[model samples]
Target: MNFTVVNKNICVDNIRMGDCSSASIFLVGDAETISLSAAFDTPPESLIVGPFVPLASP
Candidate 1:
């Protein structure tokens, strides 16, 4: 894979967020190469199925 990026003018005024998860990417500048990967494995014995419960307020 090859990429040629040319950025003349880039402006970011404001960025507002409430929550950011584990798989979140925030880029502001240019990049030549970027590769991201994720893997998750859950065994059958460790799987749990139950009702949903909201967390209490602090």
Candidate 2:
């Protein structure tokens, strides 16, 4: 999985893995490219993660 910040805002919180809110809002699991938008007055940052490749287990 890969992570990318699409925007920046003071109001926006720091993005990290295992957090569903941001990931669920942006990712749909089947897109080559995606974009994000902020709905609130403060410009919330956008994030994208996908194109995941599982590693081989030993």
Candidate 3:
């Protein structure tokens, strides 16, 4: 999954991670894309994000 700020000048803050045994998260502000790689035997729960304006992925 991916997320970004509505305005390019603005950025998402207060990031937190949870509900997964192991995963790699890559955040690219220049391209405005957050990539996630999850490793688990079963489906993992959703990630949590703090209150912030969300922008559509390019």
Candidate 4:
């Protein structure tokens, strides 16, 4: 799954592993696309983003 920020037009893949004792999952994906789209409204100018490789899910 991925968290895509629309305003910034940026996305990075994410994979969350399951713990031995847990049955419930954390975030499957950034369901709230609207909020996520707005999260990068004020990114720092000095920040340099990158192309990242996501970890494989088990």
Candidate 5:
């Protein structure tokens, strides 16, 4: 494919994140092409299904 992008101005104030476990992107400008892929392969014997525990904040 072919395209054109003309970005004049972009402003980002703040981006707060706690936890992330996959592919992510934060683009503020033009891009011709973008590709993202994520894969998780866990063994059957190594999987843990336990109780939910919240993380203690500082």
Candidate 6:
């Protein structure tokens, strides 16, 4: 199922996520997991996890 909590887009937080006041996005892929916490870390932004992050978006 695709869902979102503090994120704007679709995702599935496998567990009950903590207070996502920070936009620390943890992206998990097949071979690796990349975090966008640098750009999206800490408060008021949003939490987003997905397949790919476009260069434009990053």
In model 3, where do residues sit more than 4 Å from their true spots? 1-7, 19-23, 31-58
In model 3, the worst 10-residue window by lDDT is 17-26
Clashes of 6: 1
Which candidate number has the best TM-score?
A: 1
Give the winner by lDDT: 1
TM-score of each: 0.45, 0.21, 0.25, 0.22, 0.35, 0.20
* lDDT of candidates 1 onward, in order: 0.71, 0.50, 0.51, 0.51, 0.67, 0.48
lDDT of 2 by residue, 1-58 (tens): 8797665444535644443342345442345666766465544465445686553433
Question: In candidate 5, what are the lDDT values of residues 9-55, reduced to their tens digit?
Answer: 88889867675433456666677779877565987798787885655
Which parts of model 6 are misplaced by more than 4 Å?
1-14, 27-58
Per TM-score, what order, best first?
Answer: 1, 5, 3, 4, 2, 6
In candidate 6, list every pair of residues with a backbone clash.
22-43
**Global fold similarity of model 4 (TM-score):** 0.22
RMSD of each: 5.0, 18.1, 13.3, 14.6, 5.0, 16.2
2 or 4, greater by lDDT: 4
TM-score comparison, 4 vs 5, better candidate: 5
Q: Which residues of candidate 2, in runs, are more than 4 Å off?
A: 1-19, 22-29, 42-58
Candidate closer to the true structure by lDDT (higher is better), 3 or 4? 4
lDDT of 4 by residue, 1-58 (tens): 8665655454658755544332333553455433322345565996777875454447
Off by over 4 Å in 4: 1-36
**TM-score of model 6 (CA atoms):** 0.20
Give a tens-digit lDDT track for model 3, residues 1-58: 6665574565677766543332334454655445656465654455555575444333
TM-score, cand. 5 vs. native: 0.35
> How many clashing residue pairs, candidate 3?
0
lDDT (10s digit) by residue, model 6, range 1-58? 8754463455666855444434455444332435453454566656565575433321
Please say which candidate is ahead in TM-score: 1 or 5.
1
Question: Candidate 1: minimum summed lDDT over ten consecutive residues — where?
Answer: 49-58
lDDT of 4: 0.51
